[model samples]
Target: MVKYLDTPGGFVTKAAASLTLDAGCEFGGGVDCGSQYFLGFMAYHRAWFLQDRLALTVGGGAITNPGRYLVLLPPINGTTAASGTPYFTANPGDRYRAWDFQVAADVIPRPFITFRVEFNHRAANVPYFSGPGGVTPPGGNQGAPGSLVDGWSPDLVKTENRLTGALMVKL
Candidate 1:
């Protein structure tokens, strides 16, 4: 679930939480039999615009998940095992945690159109980002259901840096 609340003093608050059943496929699909997966976070960022032309925003947050798959984070994909098996163990204690910081800039060149650029950095105890080769399937059906599989894991990094640019139009 997610919620957004507007408060006094020009401040807004955001929060969210989610749960995944049959986590890691440990013991079938029952709630008692299967492992439980959880993810939760809350963050707030206030936008400051200078004369309605330039805008800046800053925010930070933390995340915890098992093997990066159970979290419903925006613009992030989890790591999967090549053998069609659960990559992470069912133990809830095996979860990994991460913290993120972000800064964004917006240039409101016109009334209806705006340009944005954002920079983000995340640090985790375990590896995260993809390496140079990327995570693509190999050239053969390695016993996967109607698909090919590569018997290799991605080279994950502990720290990740991302830069994004977008053009938004008000309709």
Candidate 2:
């Protein structure tokens, strides 16, 4: 289920959740059954002042995936969804969780243009975010896609903080 609310100078909220169930047999005819769940929620308030020319917003959200089947695996070593890497295996039933807080200010000089600056801080229970060294290998991608090279591993961290600016236009 999912829900969303949007109103300038008012409270906004959103929530989404999903579940997956799998029941089948493995290649060796062994029983394989499992269930995964994911839930997330976020809420924010947009306050408009100065004749509605400026606005401020603050919001936060959290997510939990008990069996991280829904989590996106980092593309280390030029890996892709179809070709997974061995450095960080995301098998079913693995735990992955994250939360984040954000604050943003927007300037709406005209009805069609908006400038925004936002700051965000996110954290995870496991090493999920990319680190300063990045996810690429030392000498770029080598060997087959998603395949490992000797003595090399991508950098991953548990926390991240960033500031971003964007210009939005609504035609």
Candidate 3:
């Protein structure tokens, strides 16, 4: 969640990310769970031989849930079927791990402004991120409270690539 720039001769620059995952646990008739993981990288900015004042940063991060739990049910539910039953899922577990890498460039045109482009790759063993179809319910508002909507499965893929651009202004 934070970025660090090292001294010209400080040997390395540091970049880090924060990851969190929660696996529900059963207690009496209730369940509870949560997890957190992170990855970081160190780099030297003196390797940009093609461009002047262009900074390149490379980093990798991980996602993991090293908890003991099962399908997480609502802490409190007033449904007619049961009070602590969890929703249905074909594949449900309390453990998972994922990894990602990013390569970003900062084109510093001035002291107060910079144009940035980043390329990232992520790979996971479980369902993560939105696919061609997003996570939102289709067609919006299927019905009112307690009404069942048409069942639909999301397109959960294993690998994803993302390209992003940003215009940063620092005062």
Candidate 2 clashing pairs?
A: none
Candidate 1 or 2, higher lDDT?
2
Candidate 3 lDDT, 21-69, residue by residue in tens: 4333333323333242222323222223223346676766654543312
lDDT of 1 at 41: 57
Candidate 2 minimal-lDDT segment of 10 residues: 22-31
lDDT of 2 by residue, 34-60 (tens): 335666766655565555567777877
- Which order, best to worst by TM-score? 2, 1, 3
Best by TM-score: 2
Ordered list by lDDT, greatest first: 2, 1, 3
Q: List all candidate RMSDs to the true structure.
A: 7.3, 5.9, 7.9
> What are the lDDT figures for the candidates, one per model?
0.53, 0.72, 0.49
Model 1 TM-score (2 dp) = 0.59
After superposition, which runs of candidate 2 have C-alpha atoms over 4 Å from their true positions?
Answer: 1-35
In angstroms, give how far residue 77 of model 2 lies from its true place.
1.2
* Model 1 superposed RMSD (Cα): 7.3
